[model samples]
Target: MIEMFGLEALSNSAQAATTVGIVFTEAIALYIGYGAVTQIVHQATREFLGGE
Candidate 1:
């Protein structure tokens, strides 16, 4: 999969870099999406959780 991106198909350096980049991107996007959802439902979420 990583090799198909015209990148070096190596087990040592390139593969590790690609894997790291993919995981980092995914984690960042997930956090951003959660933040947006939380902001959108800030009031309702507080009420549902018995908060102020």
Candidate 2:
């Protein structure tokens, strides 16, 4: 896709760095998203069970 964007001059190291950065960012996003969903489910379950 980067090459398709006319960035054929982009170096291999730059591409590797960009890939790593993107993976890291996506991992963080998924972690945060799942954490939020888990918190919501936990709260609902607790309420249903008559806990605080």
Candidate 3:
């Protein structure tokens, strides 16, 4: 029984770790995507306004 409990705990830990990793990866991707988009928009706005 103890062994089974330990196995279950380990499995849960692994699943949690995987979930965290996926979320972290997605957050980084989004941050990079938004940064790129913001730069594009900023450049476009500057061009539209005829600013240097």
Candidate 4:
């Protein structure tokens, strides 16, 4: 199944490490993306809601 994804055949430990690294990268990107989105939306809403 994994080979279908075009990754080289890796040992179990290597696969585990790669999975962990990918998961961590995804988490950081998601958090940063959402945090910036929320901050922008919050400021825009505050101004619009406050009529300022």
Q: Which candidate is the best by TM-score?
A: 4
Model 4 over residues 1-52: C-alpha lDDT tens digits? Answer: 3465555588888877777787798899999999999999999999989955
Candidate 4 wrongly placed segments (more than 4 Å): 1-5
Question: Cα RMSD (Å) between model 4 and the true structure?
Answer: 2.3
Candidate 1 Cα errors over 4 Å, as ranges: 1-8, 46-52
Better of 3 and 4 by TM-score: 4
- Superposed by TM-score, candidate 4 places the C-alpha of residue 22 at a distance from the truth, in angstroms, of 0.2
Candidate 2 lDDT tens digits, 1-52: 5564465577989877776777798899999999999999999999999999
Each candidate structure's TM-score, on Cα atoms with residue i matched to residue i, is 0.60, 0.79, 0.79, 0.82
For 1-52, candidate 1 gives per-residue lDDT tens digits of 5767656756668788887998899999999999998887997889899998
Q: Residues 1-52, candidate 3, lDDT per residue (tens digit)?
A: 3243254455767867766776798899999999999999999999999998
Error of 2 at 27 (Å): 0.7
**Residue 43 in candidate 1 has what lDDT?**
78
